[model samples]
Target: AGWQGTAAQVVTHTLNRMQDEFATNPADCLAYIGTCITQPHYEVDERVASRLPETHLKPGGKPGKWMADLKGANLAQLLSAGIPEAHIEVSPYCTWADNDHYFSHRRNEGTTGRMLAVIGIQNKPS
Candidate 1:
């Protein structure tokens, strides 16, 4: 879902897909929680911006542009879908701001190395 479209579209589409998974398997959906990278200054078309909340959006430096909060938008979607706030976690790191520790296609011009994170539940022996 990397820059597939405007932040609004990406967040909405991603939440829809997650909701589908939740419907099929609520337990697994809860276990598969994760966060989208924060986009402090994501520019989007006015049309897209209009669909997002004003609280999660900021005026871009130029006209007809917007800075979106992709993380906050995703979080709100999870909350609306009944995901507990305690079960959800948001990373404070911004890839662009933490270029030394994270890969940011926008900051690095798509020349950065890949990064991977994995989480799972280990069942107790029965």
Candidate 2:
């Protein structure tokens, strides 16, 4: 699938699952995703920053793309879903727009060479 289609599908599926989980246990239905940095002309609203403790706003690096808080956007989503302000956690590092450690879609000028890291835990019988 194309990027937009894939993203839409993932979001739709996640929302459906969240609704189901919330019906049973509301507290268990938390969603977290990394958001792309937007232009500074767009405001990073206070409802987001209040929850995330480690949001950074880097200045004057790129022309159109300003350093934004991905975790802040996620925290804002959680807060909008009625989750407590203290429950969310934000990373200290700026993902793409700031450091070279992470690949940026914006910086690459629409290149398809992005890398991602995912972690999970497996259950073991004791």
Leading candidate by lDDT: 1
* Model 2 regions lying over 4 Å from their true place: 1-16, 21-24, 29-35, 38-71, 117-126
Best by TM-score: 1
User: TM-score per candidate, in order?
Assistant: 0.65, 0.44
Which pairs clash inside model 2?
none
For 1-126, candidate 1 gives per-residue lDDT tens digits of 233343435544555665565443223345232333465646777877787777778888889988877667666766665566776777777777777888777778879788776744344489
lDDT of candidate 2 vs native?
0.43
Report residue 91 deviation for candidate 1 (angstroms).
Answer: 0.3
- lDDT (tens digit, per residue) of candidate 2 on 1-126: 122323234434544565675552324443444434443422333443333333344443444333344444445546656555565444444334553665455566566356554533233479
